[model samples]
Target: MASNRPAPEAPYVPNDPDFGGYDEQTWEEWNPTEESVRPVRGRHRVHKKGGGGLARSSTVLGVGVIAAVGAGGIATAQDGKPPVSISLPDLGAVADSLPEAKSLPGVGALISDDSAGSPADAVTAAAPLTAAGVSSADAEQGTTDAGEALRARIMRQAENQQHQADDAVRTAAEEAAVKKAAEEATAQQKAAEQKAEAKAAAKKKKEEEARKAKAEAERLAKLAKSFAIPTSSYTLTSHFGDAGSMWSSGHHTGLDFAAPTGTPLKAVHTGTVKEAGWAGAYGYRTVLELEDGTEIWYCHQSSMNVSAGQKVSTGDVIGRVGATGNVTGPHLHMEVHTSGGANIDPLAWLQGKGLNP
Candidate 1:
């Protein structure tokens, strides 16, 4: 069975002490580091002012030693016994070992728990550091630097665009030049081809002319071999169309070749003798008819070698020169008549037969 009883009285502890462990000056001079930890709530609440905690860090460390060593014991007014020997570190030596914490003009360093991720995060979770003054010059400098960067970027872009435009123009010019050169080359090729064609035509025309001339020369040479003159050793006495009363028709109608009697008179061209007997005004005359139906007469002939209906070649003796009837002197009188009975100049007519009179 349990009896209802009041709990025994515990020992007493002074929550607030009269010792001014630290002031605001100590907080200003206190150096913090990455390893620094905020004061815990057990013994560091003695110098707290209002809602803010830990006015001085020295008050925290000073009472924290008592709380730690005397955790198992408590003080009472009725007992006086030697306390447990617990050693505390020297405050002056600990303070001297810390580095000086330099801060901005009106901003102070903040104490934070070690579990905080960063100072900024800790500041957000705790108190923010305040700066005395921010400068307008600094803000303006930031704006100027941004503007300068943007300007440099824009300038680079513009230069790149300009270079691209220049490259395009250069490429266009080169293409045009190439096209023009190609055109010129094509025109030159056509001109060369035309020139060659013209030269070939001229060469062909010359060859044609030369061949015709050679053929004509050969034909003339062959024809000259078969032709002959009427008589040799004869003096020209009369020409055709010479006005004289000695001729029967008032004008001489034949070419006269005077020679000694019995001089041979040959056939001028291949023909057959048609008349071999004497005639009234022209005695001892012979009429030779050629294959082309032309008639040739030899008058004033003393004798005849080719009779009527006899074939005679060029250069055959057809008659002789003598003083016959109706002759001005002993000579051979030759007359050439066309098939149409027209008489012409014998010298010019002979030249038509390819004979130089």
Candidate 2:
């Protein structure tokens, strides 16, 4: 049989007579735990606000154990046998040792358990942490801190990569610019050289053309000095061939000019007087030869002024005209011959320059 008497109620307040004066400020200021107190092993003093006899009783209650002057201290009225030593487990130590909670994507739960595969189990079970183990606020704060740190790291890495890319682009642009400048400079140098060469060639060509023109002028002047005319004023008396009995020879071999005796005979061009004297049947004759082997003979001259081998110029008075050759009136005779002694017409040759005898 069980007794049916009701259990007695425990005392709701401390029974120590001296504990009545303890206040909330004293309790709040008291550091009871080893982690909170500065010296783990030492005598600590507690001050009393009033000098009542209860202060002496308080000192007796604090003997043989660590004590503090606060509402939660071990002080009681029942012979001050230190109030039943309550072994309250340390909540702060449990909190400090607890594993950090992880946040799972798409799963709204805090992973607090250190058991292997706990996150996966939590996801499948859809169970959250025990109500007292981890508060929702603490889990959220941890997740926010971790996420902010990760975002900061990612941003830093992205900025570094961007800087590297920009540096590479800048270097490549500089190199390209340098290469282009070099090529342009080389091209300019080559063009300058080519222009110089072209100028030099043009200058040389101009000099050669000038030299050729000078030589041609000198050649013409030399040609003009190699022949002489028979008389300055004359009329054609008997041509090289005329059907008449005017000469001893079968046919006339030279052109005859009818002019007054003592008419001034001029040299037609510049040459050495090869012969200048009287000749058989052709009195007072003068002969001149050009450098190119062409010969001129002036017959029927009244007198001679140039000697053989004497140099004479064009328009020089070389002789006087007269009909001294084979029984003709006062006239002059002229003949032109090649180096092989072939005779040619002199009237046509002289008339080529608009000169009429």
Candidate 3:
């Protein structure tokens, strides 16, 4: 009975004879055909539906997930929050077929196989940094930038304060100027008022004086009508109160009118002749008394025309001029006496009667 299968070569062993280690056997050579053999379990290669493409895609996806987790850890650490717990589904079978993490392109620097390696360090190494070791975005907002902003704010505030102070100063100056102007205006007004008042008072005083002068002139004009001159063609020689050795008195108490002898003497005003003759040094004198008791004495007369107790009118011939008693030349000595027997200047009395002798 011959079987159509090839015999396997036996291995030589140094053992006892029951295991047939010393037997000499013959092997037959045979080649197997497809029809003669059946497929054995796990002996031949079997092709899957898609190939290794799905596995490669899944590996790339896993790498991207690891990178995303690392980025999240860095962000969390920078934010100063607690570390987040991350759970991943087991992909043991896929991990076993994948290459080592360090051997992968662009991913080798991020993930580490060393147990002591820090995830933070690995993430920091992958991120781009500035000269100060911080990220570019973080460096842009660093302490220097903050300080510059603060300084700018302070400058703005100071400028505003200065402007406010200037405005206040200007306002105060304007107010003071306005007050000064008002005071000056008030002073000017008061001065003008005082000047006007003084002018009015002066004008009133002048007007009152002029009125009084007009009244006095009118009174004198009226009185001139009632008075008359005593004699005409006479020259005034001695006035009242003349000092001489020619009379009994040391001073002459009468006004002397020099004229030729026999020059007629007229009554100065309307009066009654009280006496027509003199007995002593006043030779050929005549005395006339008025209604007001004023007396007129005509002395050194050459002759008398009016008798005693005769009423005589103004301009009536009462006597004639002469040098009869104590006379150096022909002249009339006229004396006036008030009601109280006081002698007065005859010239002044004539002027009071509105007559200039």
Candidate 1 local lDDT, 166-213, one digit each (tens)? 999999999999999999999999999999999999999999999997
Compared with the true structure, all predictions reach lDDT values of 0.66, 0.60, 0.69
For each candidate in turn, the TM-score is 0.44, 0.36, 0.54
- Residue-level lDDT of model 3, residues 61-176, one tens digit each, is 44435544654544443334455443333334444554554433345475433442576545544443222233444445552244455665578799999999999999999999
Q: Sorted on TM-score, highest at the top, how do the candidates line up?
A: 3, 1, 2
On a 0 to 100 scale, what is the lDDT of residue 33 in model 3?
A: 38
- TM-score of candidate 2 against the unseen true structure: 0.36
| Residue clash pairs of candidate 1 | none
Off by over 4 Å in 1: 1-195, 234-262, 276-285, 299-303, 322-357
Deviation of model 2 at 14, angstroms: 99
Summed backbone clashes in each candidate are 0, 6, 0
**Candidate number achieving the greatest TM-score relative to the actual structure:** 3
Candidate 1: lDDT over CA atoms?
A: 0.66
Candidate 2, superposed: residue stretches over 4 Å from native: 1-229, 352-354
Quick one: ranking by lDDT, best first?
Answer: 3, 1, 2
> Could you tell me which 10 consecutive residues in candidate 2 have the lowest summed lDDT?
39-48
Task: Please report how far candidate 1 places residue 306 from its true position, in Å.
Answer: 3.3
